[model samples]
Target chain A: MLAFVITTVLCFITYLLLTTGSGTLGLWSLEEILVGAILSLIVGSLARTIFVKDNFRMLNPVRWIIFIAYVIGPFFVAMAKANVDVAYRVITGKINPGIVKISPDLKTDFGITMLANSITLTPGTLSVDVDEDKNDLYVHWINVKKKALEKKPVNYRYVCGKFPNWIRRIAE
Target chain B: MIFNLIIYILLAIGVFFNLLAGVGLLRFPDVYTRLHAGTKCTTFGSIFICGSVILIGLRMWYTGSTDGSVLAIHTIFALVAILLTNPTGAHAIARAAHRSGVAPVRAVVDDLQNNTLKKEEEK
Candidate 1:
């Protein structure tokens, strides 16, 4: 299947990256390549379903590029801002922490997982739980802004900016 | 000299954030908040630290050291491993803590139980 091939290729690439400069052929030896190929095939066949469920969209090079951009661009910027915010909170002891729910409305499992991981990775917010049936995320927010509650639909911008949009682009 | 200076700066930022993470872990009130400090700060800090090492490797490679390329690439793999695992570990911890009935301090709402109840009723 497509999933099996993609997982094999990915596992092999990871193997190659991990074993760089170990052999003679620029980065890998002929023997190492053979070993890696055999290992990758074995692992790929066993773990293909875990990586890709029913869709191969995630295997697209475009999605990977978008994911890289997501990491280096907005995610990095947000992380910096969050580090500052958390550092300030740690210093001044001025934090109003609480849990709140947000509905990102992501359908796919990968999209939901990506959004949850992003939320957990960023400072000031931890994704405490997910409502699998309704696709709602319950996030523990460090500084739960008052406006977030009063807004027409609870501004998620207060928690994570553009994260859902990027998840949509990359995973959805 | 400039490259070294840049690498130093990156390393400094990484160390500073990691130090802040440690401080936050000590100062934060509850388990959930401490998890926040423990996970995100370290992850962000490690990314920069590994990134600086990658930079060093690239510089060496550019200077005709073949090992430099290998060093950089391996550091990248380590970075990738950290990035992939850290958040997932945090998620697992948070979920476990919640499931075990550890509530956030001063939390205004607890919808998790209510949602579960709703799902049960619907079923």
Candidate 2:
């Protein structure tokens, strides 16, 4: 119920911002504010009921701050590194191309999403698919690790590296 | 001047994110990952771009331009369309990739494939 109220308030505030403080029928009016509040309350309740599950637990605010920090920090750095690697591959055509699987230990959907998105942002690798039940991802590598590919039970430790760990920080 | 600054800032942010999506397409490791990055980032970036356009249109409307309102509203509709379709398309691509047996590197067990194969044999 409290979540509904907060959501409604936020929606109302956004409505005001988007409308640029303007009221319908030419002038700002108290009636408009009241109508906006009521409308937003209904919309917020609908949104809460539809998108948010009942069992969802709210995280500590500090955790969110940490998550954003990781997104800006390590994630960006990884993206930059991938950029260089991909650019080199594009120029030199040094790709040992093939499909490979990497099993990440991350459990949650959001964590997996973050990992997948981070991987996709990097060059020379494409996330082909995810086996949700097994928590595995199939990636098409522009440059495969020769040693890992040669070995049965490929050492994906090298392929996936610190990605899933970093993703855990941001999303899980 | 402040309005112009805000519009320009939104435009720059939108363009930057769009470039990130493009780079993501070139760099990511697999088809599914590429779709994830390409779809979500582009959608986000497009929101900002369309937002800026809306702002500019509103500003023009305020300054007595006749076409501003129509332009602003249309851009918003387009933004909504992109938001609605992009994720659904990405989900389809991911499912197709999985069905095609492009497994993740180092994955231990594939439950989806097992289930699908089971269903196939039942038929």
Candidate 3:
């Protein structure tokens, strides 16, 4: 029931965000509100299990703040650098492409997922696969650094600088 | 006037990055590298484009237009959606390509394949 309510509320918020300025009731109309409520409830009930899962640690507001900080800070900077790196490669056609594996030591599926998504967006590395048993990630690196492979399983820092720590603080 | 200049600059950056994404897609040699181009560039480009829209909306709201509030909020949501889905989609494509026996062209190393081989041998 808690999960149901949580999912419903989240869905409703999303609906409201989408339907903003549709009515005079402070950016939402009575009809819009009513429709949104009903739709979100239905969608929420159906999606509660999948959406909420067993771990609700993400519901903590502090984690949300950290996530926002991460997006604005290191994440944004890395994305800019990633673009420039890609642009350089695109123009000069220089690449040392390879697939390397790294164990971020993240325990939860959510953390791994977040890390993978962040890795994809932030650098020349794209997450290619996962080792579910050990929670290992296979990363497609545009530039394979020799220092990164000086040790086995590689290092998360070399692939995604300081991201694992940030994700750990937020997700774990 | 200053806002217009900022918006123009943001739009130019956004368009330039998006165009880079397209060029990278064509210029890269393999599925993984192309995805590295297609996904990251577009995601970064969209951020700038949406940032410009959000700025416009904020300016309008500052000028006392209620509709601008909705516009800015909605644009933020769109940006969040792109941020969430784009990378996941890229991951899916990369995973599928790897699993379907497509090798990374000119790859100096392939640990994922070695892992798979080890798993197969273990079984």
Q: Model 3 over residues A36-110: C-alpha lDDT tens digits?
A: 999999999899999988978988999999999999999999999999999999999999999999989999998
Give each model's clash number.
0, 24, 0
Query: lDDT tens string, model 2, A2-33?
Result: 66766787788756544433444543357767
Sorted by DockQ (best first), the order is: 3, 1, 2
- Going through the candidates in order, their DockQ values are 0.70, 0.15, 0.82
In terms of DockQ, which candidate is strongest?
A: 3
TM-score for each predicted model, relative to the true structure: 0.91, 0.58, 0.94
Flag regions of model 1 displaced more than 4 Å: A151-155, B116-123
| Model 1 C-alpha lDDT per residue in residues B56-95, reported as the tens digit of each score | 9999888987788799998988888898788788888888
Displacement of the residue B77 alpha carbon in candidate 2, Å = 15
Better of 1 and 2 by TM-score: 1
lDDT of 1 by residue, A29-121 (tens): 888899999999999999988987887787678989999999989888878877888888889988788877888878998899888888988
Top-scoring candidate (TM-score): 3
Per-candidate Cα lDDT values, in order, are 0.85, 0.65, 0.92
